[model samples]
Target: MRAAVFTALCISLSAGAHVLLSANPLPLGMLAALSAGVFAVAFLLAGRRERGYWSIAALLVPLELAADTVFTTGQHTCYGQSGGPVAGSMRSLGLDLLCSGEFGTPLARMTARGEALAGTAASPWLLLGAHVGVGLVAAAWLRRGEAALAGLLRAAAAVAFRPLLLAVAIVTVAPVRSTGRPGRRSDRTRAARPRPHLLHSVLRRGPPCPAAA
Candidate 1:
């Protein structure tokens, strides 16, 4: 379940990036709302006891890709572009590759010159390859049983160690001393109480002396 949720989250982030890079970008508010919705669903799935929610990941991947493809194609068309949907999608994919350093200067030049049609035609295959590669890596990581919430928390803590340390320092420097002072008065009262005289009690409780008997 954790693995599935993680995969969905990764795909969602990739889709969000695609939206941001598209020629007609979505408003930041809309993107934020969409992301919040996705995350809320993912959070619910993560907390579920049953594994049925894992199936949603299977649906999210294709949905995300298709949405990105459609959005990119629409943006290109709306901008009075010369290329078709395939070319537009290809350019988007190329841009992604360029940003990620998977594609070199040649592809970047082609995209820059609006000559990315040929490359775009070949991009679907490349996109599939990239997805497969990422999936394999995620699978390997998940197979190690390292996809739990605890692992996520540890990763977050590791990444935010400096801030966490600062927070700890702040709390330590300004410790909240208890105002009620719970054990102090109790301790003084107990100390002031007179203890029983052991010897006196023993003699008083002793059986009548033999001489008195």
Candidate 2:
């Protein structure tokens, strides 16, 4: 429990620092080093635990990616841009990448442009990759050693092999309700209802009120 808590704290601090210091490469580099070192220590702590640390370490990867997406987008809207729609339709691209890995290239390009303009910002791709590396390192260093790595791989495979699980995950993580059109009801309900026949409708209308009399 202590190790899990510490790991979560480290991840939060790392993500928050990245979002806050994204505009300063020097500080971002320093943060990178500091975060790596801290994660190493956290992994070492996980090594002392009996079980479940691997799962915690595994969680760090997606959590870090998600945090980067959320915090960076928020930072961009609040600090990088004026009061507006925020990156148009591509604001949550980072989190979006989780479900659709194809967006990785576009996201990298977008960040590369921003980084070029800022002249000090770190590439989000590199930053996130480094965080993922930290989590993998922690998993490898866990007390269970090879078993931990195997478990991680197995879990990943389970998700990868099952399309339903993937779809369910996308549904769970996506902002479906928020993005959907207002007042739209479920299609299933509409489909289940019995449709009125054209003859029945005509009869109900009583021959169109006798041709309007």
Candidate 3:
């Protein structure tokens, strides 16, 4: 529960800082400093666990994607453009890709479409990269002697535990009985065996008790 709270707080502060830095008219240098401070505090409060950092990434990434969708649709509407939902979604995805620093003809096309918003001098790519970088660092730090990739995979699994558990439960079932019939039979066989005595072997005799009497 404490981990969850810490994760939530870190993600919330990071998301808020990103939005303020991107959409507000505040001084870039000051915003950057404040954002850095907030992130440092969040990191310290969240502890040195990979899950906390991955939790931050898991929450922040989706948020940025949603924000991109809203920003794209709002910008188009503001410009009196009539792009439908599909087009708007595509534009949003393209913008998200741009924010990830995946530059190419697709980004050029998006830029040509006049999707750029004012007061966004702070690049989304930089913000996302920084977030991911921090996550990687945290994962590395927590991994210790283990492989970084393994730690990252664990963090990813931890973040997606609910869905993973559901999938696993759907695909598998518990056994109806722990012990099989064969196991019970073996126990019975052991119990029914006669006990051996040291005197029986030494005093072995034929069935002539009546003749000896």
Q: lDDT values of the candidates?
A: 0.48, 0.51, 0.45
Candidate 2 Cα errors over 4 Å, as ranges: 1-4, 16-21, 24-53, 82-122, 138-213
Candidate 1: list runs displaced more than 4 Å: 1-30, 50-60, 70-74, 77-119, 139-213
Per-model TM-score, in order, reads: 0.35, 0.32, 0.26
lDDT of 1 at 195: 86
Reference-based lDDT, residue 195, model 2: 88
Model 1: pairs clashing at backbone N, Cα or C within 3 Å: none
**Top lDDT: which candidate number?**
2
lDDT of 1 by residue, 1-213 (tens): 453456455555444434323222332333344455556655765554433323544544554555456444444443325532334664565533322211122323434423443236665565555454444554454434444655677788888897888888998896656648567888869867998777355444858889899
Better-scoring candidate (TM-score), 1 or 3 = 1
Candidate 3 local lDDT, 1-213, one digit each (tens): 334443444444344433433332122223333345545554565554445445555544554344343433443432224422224664465533322221123322434323343325646665566555555554444334234655777889888897888889977977565444556777879867987767355655667777687
lDDT by residue for model 2 (70-104), tens = 54554444334442332445546542222221112
Model 3 CA lDDT for position 168 = 94
Best by TM-score: 1
Which has the better lDDT: candidate 1, or candidate 2? 2
